[model samples]
Target chain A: EPEVTQTPSHQVTQMGQEVILRCVPISNHLYFYWYRQILGQKVEFLVSFYNNEISEKSEIFDDQFSVERPDGSNFTLKIRSTKLEDSAMYFCASGTTNTGELFFGEGSRLTVL
Target chain B: TQLLEQSPQFLSIQEGENLTVYCNSSSVFSSLQWYRQEPGEGPVLLVTVVTGGEVKKLKRLTFQFGDARKDSSLHITAAQPGDTGLYLCAGAGTNFGNEKLTFGTGTRLTIIP
Candidate 1:
């Protein structure tokens, strides 16, 4: 089965540094999303992207966060300045249909110190 | 913000025992999905329930969508040790552009052999 793939399975960076997490969604998937889970907390939606633009975002997705579909296959999330609270597991998901069945990539664990 | 609350944050059961995990919310959703996540990995989609009062079975696992589309349940019959993982239920609203999902507080299950 085709699955979404992500780069940098684990990333550790200092506070106030820029970090980028990359994902390659399934070949034919149309919708993409980014979600984060703080340790011992529920997963929180960050942003959703479709048609090369952000469809919707949550309050947690503030100005410091940005998502881009640089190419047909690559979707990236950038955090301009990482905060200690930003340490979490970020997951990238893709779906071919609107039924909410998404395939998630192995998350990128971001550790800010 | 929509919140999905899952019952029994943690469960440990012996092999061959039956268990049910619930996901509930006050807001109605267009669809609900169940995912299983292992440690150090992203969630993997287990099933999607769209219509109200819908039921779907995958092998020994049975999923049910509530009549009001505001809740869901996963029941495993005679579960095996392989059924251990963190189970999450996500709800998708009727947003215009590829709806974003609101995830529930997860249920961590450990199946003892």
Candidate 2:
């Protein structure tokens, strides 16, 4: 079975530094998403991307967060200035359509000090 | 904003016990998905329920979508130690082509052998 893949299984960085998480979605999938889960908290949606642009974002997805599908295969999430609260497990997910079935990659754990 | 609330935040039972976890929401969804996440890993999709009052079974697990499309449930029969994990329920909005999933608070289950 094809699955989504993510880079940097774990990342630790100081507050106010830039961080980037990369994901390679399942081939032939058309929709992509970024979601985060704080320790002991529920998973929260950050943004969704389709057609090489963000289709929708949640209130938590502020100006500091940006997502790009730089190449056809790689989708990236960048945080310009990390905050202590940004520490969480970030998951990358992909789906072939709006049908709501998505495959997620093993998350990239980010710890900002 | 859509919200999914799951019941019995944590459960621990003997390996042969049968258990049920629920996911409920005030807002109707186009689809609802159940996922299982182990420590240090992203959520793995277990099943998706789309039509109202639909039921799907995957081996020892069974899933049901409420008639109103605002609630769903998962029942596991004769659970094994391997069934331990955090279970999350996600709901997709009725908006067409918008694939963002709003996740539930989650239910953590541990089956003791």
Candidate 3:
């Protein structure tokens, strides 16, 4: 079965440095999303994208966070400046439609020093 | 914001035992989905329940959505060591244009041999 794929499985960056997490969603999927989980916390929604635009975002997705579909297959999340609290497992997910079942990537573990 | 509360944050049971994990919320949802995540991996979708009081079975695992659409349960029968993982439940609302999922805190199950 086709699945979502993410790059840089693990990343270590200095605080205040820029970080970009990349994802290639299922080819036919139309809706894409980003979510994060702190070491021992629940998965939290960050943002959703469709038609190459952000549909919704949570408070955690502040000015420092941005998402882009620079190409047909790549969806990237960039943190302009990393903070200690930004360390977490970031997941990329996609669905055929707004209400369809979501498929997730393995996730990128971000560690900010 | 809608919140999903999962019961019994951690469960350890012997092989061949049965267990049930629950997801509850005050807000009603249009659909509920169950996912399983192993260590170092992203969540994999197990099942999706759309209608109230719907029941779906996947081999030894069974999922049920409450009649009010505000709760759901996952029951595993004759669970084996392979069944051990983190189980998360997520809800999606019909009115949300982006259809973002609200995930529960998750239940960590350990099936001991």
Tell me the deviation in Å of residue B97 in model 3: 7.6
lDDT of 3 at A86: 100
Across all candidates, what is each one's fraction of true contacts kept? 0.75, 0.72, 0.58
RMSD of 2: 1.0
TM score of chain A per candidate:
0.97, 0.98, 0.98
List, residue by residue over B3-80, the lDDT tens digit for candidate 3.
999998999999999999999999999899999998878889999998899999999999999999999999999999
Which stretches of candidate 2 lie above 4 Å from their native place?
Answer: none
Q: Given candidate 2, what's the lDDT at residue A103? A: 88
User: Candidate 3 docking category?
Assistant: medium
Across B26-111, the per-residue lDDT of candidate 2 in tens digits comes to: 99999999999998899999999999999999999999999999999999999999999999999988764467898999999999
For residues A29-91, write the lDDT of model 2, one tens digit per residue.
Answer: 999999999998998999999999999998989999999998799999999999999999999
TM-score, candidate 1, is: 0.97
Task: Write the candidate numbers in order of decreasing DockQ.
Answer: 2, 1, 3
Q: Which stretches of candidate 1 lie over 4 Å from their true place?
A: none
lDDT of 1 by residue, A25-94 (tens): 9998899999999988888889999898998899999999999998688999999999999999999999
